[model samples]
Target: MSAEEKKTRQMPKGGRKGGTIFPRIALQDAVGYARRLVSKTHTSRQPRDVIYSGVVGAKAGIGDVRISALKQYGFLDGDAKSGYTADELAKKIVAAPPEELPHLYGQAVLKPTVFKRLFDTFQSDTVTRAKLKQRAADLKVHPDETDTCVELYVASLATAGLVSVDGDRITHLASADMSETAAISVVTDENNQSLSNNSTVNSPATRIDAGSDTEAAASDIGEEDKNGFPVPPGNSAQPAPRANFNVNVTLDSSMDIEKLQKQLELLKRFGAI
Candidate 1:
């Protein structure tokens, strides 16, 4: 045989000598395989090599293949070092903004619970109870039930688009407009009640009558006390007039007038007016 023919015959079918051998798989392909395994199992505790071999075998319909490609490519750590927990990894994946996620975990569907964890991380830092109580007092509202009051305030923040709920965390998303809206609502409600109370106090029906002799004597004593003068014997100063303006405003403005009137009627019927 010619030397060229002899050399050609000695070469393997696909270019190598002896038995046919394939080139090592690319790192990207190995990573893809590993990712697929993790996603399928939904657990990270499995033996990394076993999972990789199973995935590759399942896909290629071949005999046991070496997972050395995964190790060489840095897809598998292969050491006993403690890495971040699955929950922590899931949290990181979820917290990643929609635009930035494609660069991190590649293309994969994230579960809702994972997203919730991300949200919780964002919302973990929130307004404290003391701060909320101070805010309530500043707004002239009695925060009798501090716990419920804070919860209601947080709900209000959510409704006003100033905050969002990410799992158990209360994430603040307040903009200048949102703050202004909340502040304006609180101030307006307080001012409206103050004006209503003033109107009620100045109403003619609430004026004290001084026509009777007993009423005149009481007024005389009250005037003496107001003028910083001493009162004579057997003459007691009148008690200061206490005007109680119990103003209850309806929170639901979306309700029709007829519905509101019916609610008022119901309250009156129940002697709650």
Candidate 2:
């Protein structure tokens, strides 16, 4: 290649505004370095020299690359000027329980400034190797290196359980927190709709109009409304204005005696049964 062409190739492409540039290493590799650092220093701050010596040993060039990767992955905190330390997440990944690893790694993978931004941008969409390569190019990574970098980033995400790959297709996996939030929303909506849509208690979802069988059933109720069912409001002639409500109870084979007993006791406490 010509000298000018070679010079251009050396320049970082994706997003090249400023600073020391890319890590050029996968997140797993950087984390291995972090575990080595933690074995000696734990999470305590250490001068860059001491920290580097612990992880890198004699390979100075590879050390720079790996160290840059660690900082990018958020495994390392502090700066060259202030020295470096293993970040809390990094220490946890190295020593925390297996149950905690998935979450910790999910968080760590997004620490890199470039990958995090790209993830946010494409979070809702399925990712492809080609798509990631283009994104890496957008981040100022050189065209030739985009393919290699995309593979590394994808592999790192997979290690963290942050995505599932189907042959050539890759899908972003939801975090446990996101899955939990969605589950809660679904439960709340279903309950709100099922309990009170102005529908009847069982069989038919008939309207609870004035003087409906529902009100007569309440005449037997003493004073206060039981289980939200409207009771007769005194001896007034208003005939207990129409009110819509629904209470659907299902008795299935799975309803064990112990479970049924607890529910019955609760209802009895409230004079509901």
lDDT agreement with native, every candidate: 0.44, 0.69
Question: What residue runs in model 1 are displaced by over 4 Å at the alpha carbon?
Answer: 1-23, 58-66, 79-98, 101-273
State the lDDT of candidate 1 residue by residue for 1-273, as single tens digits.
Answer: 789988777644552222211113432354455555445445554453445355556423231232433333234333323421123333344455543433333212111222222223334356455655555444434445434444544543353344566555566642344445556656866887897878866666556542577986775444333434434334447543333446486667687987677666644433456
TM-score of each: 0.20, 0.54
Off by over 4 Å in 2: 1-21, 174-273
Candidate 1 CA-lDDT value: 0.44
lDDT of 2 by residue, 1-273 (tens): 789988777655684434324557777777778788777666467777776687756345666677778877778778778877777777878877565566667778887776776677666568788887777788877776777677877888888777678877778754555466546656865876887884555434343343567776656454654454334455876554443444356899888987777666645444454
For candidate 2, the lDDT comes to 0.69
Error of 2 at 85 (Å): 1.8
Clashes of each: 0, 7
The clash tally of candidate 2 reads 7
